[model samples]
Target chain A: MKTLSSTWKEMKKYRHSYLMIAPYYLPFLVFTVFSVLMAMGLSFSYFNVLETPRLIGWQNYINLFLQDDIFSIAMKNTFLFVAITGPASFILCFFVAWVINEMRPKVRAAITLVFYAPTLAGVSAFAIWKFVFSGSEYGLVNAFLLKAGLLMEPLTYLKDIRFILPILIVVQLWMSLGHSFLAFIAGLQTVDRKLYEAAAVDGVRNRWQELWYITLPVMRPFLLFGAVMQIAQSFGVSAVSINLLGFPTTKYAGRTIVTHLMDYGIIRYEMGYASAIATILFLMQVIFNKTVQRGLKRIGE
Target chain B: MTNRLNRSVGGTLFLLFFLGFLGIFMVIPLVFTISNAFKPLNEFYLFPPKLFVRNPTLTNFTDLKQILANFWIPFTRYLFNSLWVVVLGTGGHVLFVSLAAYPMAKHDFPGKNLLFSITVLALMFSPEVTKIPNFIIMSKLGLIDTYTSMIIPSLVFPLGLFLMKQYMEDLPDSLIESAKCEGASEYAILFRIIIPLVKPALMTIVLFNFTFVWSQTSGEMGGGYIFSEKLKTLPYVLVQITQGGFGSMQVFAWDGIVAVINFLLISIPIAVFLITQSSIVETMATSGIKD
Candidate 1:
């Protein structure tokens, strides 16, 4: 590392560059960077909204792991979500973008919109699924099953512990083709067409061979980006869960770490405990992303 | 010849079939939401829950208007609040992110790599990790219950900066070098040369920020910040009305109105996206994250 004096001198030399970045960076430091540091620090203290934080050592972390049953369930469910949705969405996005990339430009744009509209609609659109899965006899799925004699009675899909996680997974996947998908589409367009001709001349026989040799390596950067986006999203799957199945679902069935954090931080106002949960989640994502980044570097090698 | 070598006809057909199947799942919810908005109340409760309305009516729209009219604050006030916040938030975010991104993409500055690394680190985690601390900071700044609380925090989106930097890097150094040799000011070169060249990236930023800020007006971002009734926004009010703000009992009778409001909430962003989709595609084409 450079000495502090030399670093300061360099900053002064590029003062114009510093000036350009300050408007955005200063607020970013206060809002994002400082908040992250404060959360990490607060995880070790006991602070409710009404009182000053009292240093409590590792009490929050201990309680979170050893004593809290609900936290364990939340942890399990969060891992399940990240494991399933993260890779599923990442591969699905790349595949869908690859398929559509071969279509005519006008047709491609329309098809992209079809897949992307759900994400663009944000969380509010998830309400439509409520009607489809509504518990009453008049609910779409229930009514269809009843008419078809497939079920003896109406089923409340959202409330059923057996179905809640699966349904959440499906809905999450439905909206999963979001930012990364768009990035993939853009990345696919950048792959030079001439590479395929060159590869074919080199005796590449089939589409899979071409993809393995040419496309995957060429798109590695985007694949890495898409992986990070999916990891972040799948780990933070609270809004859709809360919107669909209420905050603490049946027996906390669909409760993820984020919902658990919300339970403490927002409702109970146990800022210290919530920070511990947040720090765990933050660590999980960073570690997972680092691993994925390394793995993506080996793609097509 | 290259196309034939790269893709078999059977492979193309199979992929199309798979796409078509997935497209059904993707499109049905949207179609159901739209069709339900026009469904008469009786059709809403029909046996077997019809996907299409046999008799369409505007009663849901009229009911929404009536519910909104009964609010203590005028509906237009919420509209104005949403409009200004979205405009200012989206515009400021794009401008600030792009300004910071230019130097990081093109210049050699102290701590540049460190700042960019922090940005990548930030991108790995979601905002929930920092929500409580951000709230504390907002309260400390005396920005609570104000528009600044909403607009100011969103001005430095890392995704926008990352994308902008990537797009800007694709531009050859010679372009900027030539402009510099002519003794042009940094501001002039940025505004006259760089900005116009990077329109696709700007469009991408604008579209993403617009969708984000539009949805945020509904109290997701502003829920803790803005407490006053008059300071509330259109979507927040709509959510309140549909999710039993007036009363849960009344909401049961207004299912059609809820669908109508959901349609309105989602369509605006989708429409804005449709208008800017082409430019976004262009922007993303160069948006690869190079090390």
Candidate 2:
């Protein structure tokens, strides 16, 4: 006891550094590490808070990948959502940012804020999109079409699988435009204005030529960064879609992998199956991140 | 000379079209939300939608009040709950992230590199996958339905820590070493030397976190609307209002409430942030520039 106490007192001599770090470090370890380990453990068995986890081995994973139709839908839809929205948002935001960056600083800030305003709409506007695309005569889009003398009847935009995915894509595009747009704008500002002046002196008459010669080359890292971020973001579509459109509407078109996990975990209390779905999502995201990183490095080099 | 004139006209037209599209895309929804709020009950069903309200009255506002009364709890309580989470969550995040980031920024502490890697990896794994386990852990902590549960789980601010670390790394090492050599304690160095220098980054962190946290708290993810209606946040309340939680006659009325709250909740902070330190946005953007 005396020896241990002496050792502890000696350790206290360097305690200032650790104490400075302890507040952030200790809580992070507990919640992040401990919580994550508990989740991995939960995947091995059938445990809800109500009862002891029954050991189930690989049964949960097998059923999830093989038998669960909803899981399959979730995988397909989520990937498709990521594929479409990710690149489109990036290109569009980059284009806008590039244009805005050409303007004076105040004008650039004004345009940037104008683009950022949609994000402020948050999910509330998305909910309004439900009304906008509502199937009935009450729907704004349908009502517009009807009054335009274009259509004989109202279209059920949310219900059909065809329209559901497009609706989700458009909404995602609208909300996501601002943040990455800001990121790209920030990236654009870093380009040396001297590069453009030199290019113009060399008789680069057009914007496209300037972009190829000056902007893209200079802002490659930021562009790659924005692209990867968009990919990560578009794949993370579960929260917004799930909130706006509940699961299993018109053949489960809107379900994403995260929503699938949420269904099993939160609503169904199937902790094991949920964990399995999450594990797959984690694996897939890891692959996507790696591919993008490789792509960035290759482009950079 | 004529060809040059034509090209200039074409360029201007292209800019106008592009800028116009972006403007409409951003503005229409805001216009829609505000327009819908003011639309009379009969106008809600009108085809092609009335662009402007003919009889704009306090009726929707009055109806919103009546509808709010029908809720299991008062609408203002949800507003307060949202405000509470933002205040505490933002405070906790700003404090802890700066605390953790300052040492990592200045000191060559052991395991700093490893700690940084962990934080970066944490950002990749979105909260979606972790929802189940996090929920279970929250339940175990007896925080499932409380305001603390909503705020505490996300309070780690790993992203903020990384941002703060990146920002603080830009500072000269001599700034801190001088303080240390002056017989100032580590805490004193952090409090006196570090925090003051990182004001722009601090503002950026606060702005981004405020918006992010505000948006999240308004959703079902925070369990903001599930139980204890009094504890529901503004977004959840808006959801309820939209989904007809207030009953039929009061739908437009409730829409007004949703509008007012959403506008108030977001615009107040944004206006304050933008108005006071609009310059910060440019500075932060430039600071973020890698040169």
Model 2 C-alpha lDDT per residue in residues B142-192, reported as the tens digit of each score? 877788866765467566676688778878989887877889988788888
Report the CAPRI category for model 2.
Answer: acceptable
Question: CAPRI band of model 1?
Answer: medium
> Poorest 10 consecutive residues of model 2 chain B by lDDT?
B1-10
Worst 10-residue lDDT window for candidate 1 chain A reads A120-129
> How many clashes (backbone atoms < 3 Å, residues ≥3 apart in a chain or on different chains) does model 1 have?
1
Worst 10 residues of 1 chain B by lDDT: B245-254
The top-ranked prediction according to TM-score is 1
Model 1 DockQ reads 0.71
Tell me the spans in candidate 1 whose CA falls farther than 4 Å from its real position.
A1-6, B1-3, B219-222, B246-253
Error of 2 at A191 (Å): 2.7
Q: Please give the range of 10 consecutive residues that has the lowest summed lDDT in model 2 chain A.
A: A292-301
How well does candidate 1 score on lDDT at residue A167? 88
In candidate 2, what are the lDDT values of residues A185-205, reduced to their tens digit? 766766766777777778888
True-vs-predicted CA distance for residue B131, candidate 1, Å: 0.4
